[model samples]
Target: MIGCGIGGAAAIIILVVTMAFPGSTTTTSDSSILVDPTKEKQSLFTLARVMIQNTGNIPLTNITIDYGGGAKDFIPTLKSGKTIILSPPDGNSLQFVRVTADGGIDVYKAYREPVAMPGMMGS
Candidate 1:
């Protein structure tokens, strides 16, 4: 009746006021760098030549490059328009590469299929 309606309205107002304040939320800044990877084939092995380019106006430092999950390395710094090349253990053998820059991260994946030779059968 009248008492029940007043109680429900008071509860709803209290709930709305409780939700109006900011609580456990957080904010993060993210950024990225440019990366290029090329495949190199040797007599018996293949290699990946990666070029990391800093295109942003800010100078990127303490950059990390992860070649799949097997290997990782760090670069001291990369100024704008600067580039660095990296050769993984084996060219094109790794399926993924991850680069962590100043405030952002980038992941690159390569999926390659072998082309059939003149007389090569299925696969």
Candidate 2:
């Protein structure tokens, strides 16, 4: 009975935190470039999974991605409809991801706390 009560309280706290802070969201000054990570598959095998879409007619170059620690500069030129996936050095939980394109820069903030997925721990 005591254990059950504690578990219930913990569940409530998790719910509150998840509700207060949502998952990755994008904020950008430019509309040509769209950085979407939610659409990509997030797996433990990779650090970060993101899809960079260039909507403008011109090509995008000198792409830069920055997470909590540092920035990762990509050399490959991005044409229209070309997407790229970036990964952190550690290959794990990323606090946030910031992307800079030719037009402008965009920042995507992650949730404050991580929510556990079903059967991730191999129950």
Candidate No. with top TM-score? 1
Best by lDDT: 1
User: What is candidate 1's lDDT per residue for 1-123, written digit by digit as tens?
Assistant: 999999999999998875552121111242346666555444565545667777666677788878875688899888867778887764334666677765645555452323335654432
Please give the RMSD of candidate 2 to the true structure. Answer: 9.3
In candidate 1, which residue pairs get closer than 3 Å at backbone N, Cα or C atoms, i.e. clash? 46-91, 47-91, 48-91
lDDT of 2 by residue, 1-123 (tens): 999999999999999986754543333443366655432234544324555667656677677776656546564578866666665566445556667755564556452433456865421
Show model 1 residue runs off by greater than 4 Å.
1-32, 90-92, 111-123
Q: Assess each prediction's global lDDT (C-alpha) against the native.
A: 0.62, 0.58
**119: Cα error in model 1, Å:** 22
Error of 2 at 118 (Å): 8.9
